[model samples]
Target: MDDIHAPTVASGLSSGIAPRDVSKVSMPDLMQEKERIEAELSALSSVLNSHGVNMNSSLTTFDGFPRDDIDIAQVRTTRVRIIHLRNDHKAVMTHLEKGLHDHFARLQNAPGATSANGTTVPSSAPTSVTDNSIADTGTLGTPFARVNSVEPGSPAHQAGLKMGDSIRGFGSVHWLNHERLSKVAEAVQQNEGRPLTVKVTRKNESGSGTTELDLQLTPRRNWGGRGLLGCHIVPL
Candidate 1:
């Protein structure tokens, strides 16, 4: 494992797990923490939106006095927290990137290692890096959505899809052009019964970390389940 040290954010807001702590943790733990921070940031953003303000919105009137329209103190606090979390998010991502490199390096260095005789050697079951998608662990890109549910014995299950997997790419759909997941629907509809390369970042089980995957999902209907994919997804 790599000893990655994340930068600290200076703010009144809690800085989340310390850099030293992260250095000792695995990639999956870091990923979960990243998701937690993102969720909090989303909630705080909603608060600002509810108050009819944004990060760039001025909280002062032309007279330069604090505006009475919104709760200035709460808004300021939320803004600070958001900023701090963003910085923390960046740091965690950096650590994750380094961890990913180290993980691959280990795999490449001794994939199916054998003795000098070169006879067939028995080894431990390949560490289940997370579901059947483990073999498809190279397309780690920016996630646009997250799997919320997956029906058993369904097409999604057959394709190795699992709940909580963050979707990076789905056929022609990606983070920048997902368009509120409308593109996802379009891709699915257009590629029904055909294999679509679905990329995702999945958190490993137990004390392990996270891994990226590229599943070949062939969407169809009436496979002992409702809908084509039999899964629910929500935008991240």
Candidate 2:
């Protein structure tokens, strides 16, 4: 994990330049930049986790701690890199929020737009909308992790988890600052062999919408697997 380094933007932007000035850029480009930054952040998080370090943990906790098998210098360097990447990621999100605001503002001022109850309503807005009412039922909460892989005959597999399933909720793990999926790991360790509720979103075959599903998984040792989960859960 020491060899793992912070990933650069997929757009090939050089360092030392402000990367969130996308005011004039099209929506597609803004989205692409957001995706790239998100991927980089996820990669950095995985690197930190591989070293038995939680991304949200304070760096000072490592000071004067045992490091016979770990490179303290590398840990410090990676922590600094993660900080910079987080700032950049936040900037990109801010840019996207501003872009959306500007877009809606334009639509509100567009010709024939109506103001209803002090709220601007676009005239071309759909008269009726279909409600995919799975939020409250299917999903226990907002999705925070994604299942990357599940081992065959493992707890995850027996629980009906598949690759690409977005984990909406697992035990007490919610969407609150779940960039490292550390809460899920903690829950697994504390509730071994106990059934834990898992909520996930699976894409429909037609790719038009998503369907949420609830599953029960029990974590235990000596499962003849590598990890307690027997599956890779990455922050989404």
Candidate 3:
């Protein structure tokens, strides 16, 4: 004969009996215990979420990195630093662009600056000596030979040739193309004292491509590179 009463978990727990010995605890007591455990779990979940963990991952092992301590001030500092770097970069770029533009403008203006003499400084740009009819005339577009600078005593200078004049026409070639003009200039450059007849034209008016000065002269080893006259000719 055996005592048929089932043991209770609370009595066993209080008595230091293993939970496995629990067989019959009142329904209400079990329900209360379950509710208390659920409440504790809910509180723990809330704490984890505040610390940066996503609450949805609490029940799943696959839930990614658990939330840890969050520092709002650190995040703000990082953002500000990024913005500051971007602004500084923009400012530096703007300054460099302006400087580059100013440098080029100075280069262009240098050609027209005045010299120490009372007379307005002659332009530094190169000149050409030729007639209007390129080829057997004056040719333009020939970089092969350009007027360097007119010498103080030169035939082209007497002919009023200036610096930066381009040969536009040559014997028998009017409106000479670049190729033909280059060929003529090449010949003139080879023979410095050959007394090669040349022509130079200058822009008569600003921005007026059609209007230009027509001067007929000869090639001379002037001040600059192989050009049409004796003075000086520099690249434009």
Which candidate has the highest TM-score of all?
1
What are the lDDT scores of the predictions, listed in order? 0.74, 0.66, 0.42
| Best lDDT among the predictions, by candidate number | 1
Higher-TM-score candidate among 1 and 3?
1
Clashing residue pairs in candidate 1 (N, C-alpha, C atoms within 3 angstroms): 28-209, 28-210
Candidate 1 lDDT, tens digit per residue, 85-204?
777777776676567656655655576766559854454334322222432444345687999999999999999999999998887676433546877899899988999998888998
Candidates ranked by TM-score: 1, 2, 3
Write out the backbone clash pairs for model 2.
none
Model 2 scores worst on lDDT over the 10 consecutive residues at 126-135
Q: What are the per-residue Cα lDDT tens digits for candidate 2 across 77-192?
A: 66666677677666655665555455555666787776657665754421111112222322226576789899998899999999999987787565532335755788898999
Clashes of each: 2, 0, 52
Q: Whole-model lDDT, candidate 1? A: 0.74
Which portions of model 2 miss their true places by more than 4 Å?
1-140, 177-179
Weakest ten-residue segment in model 1 by summed lDDT? 1-10
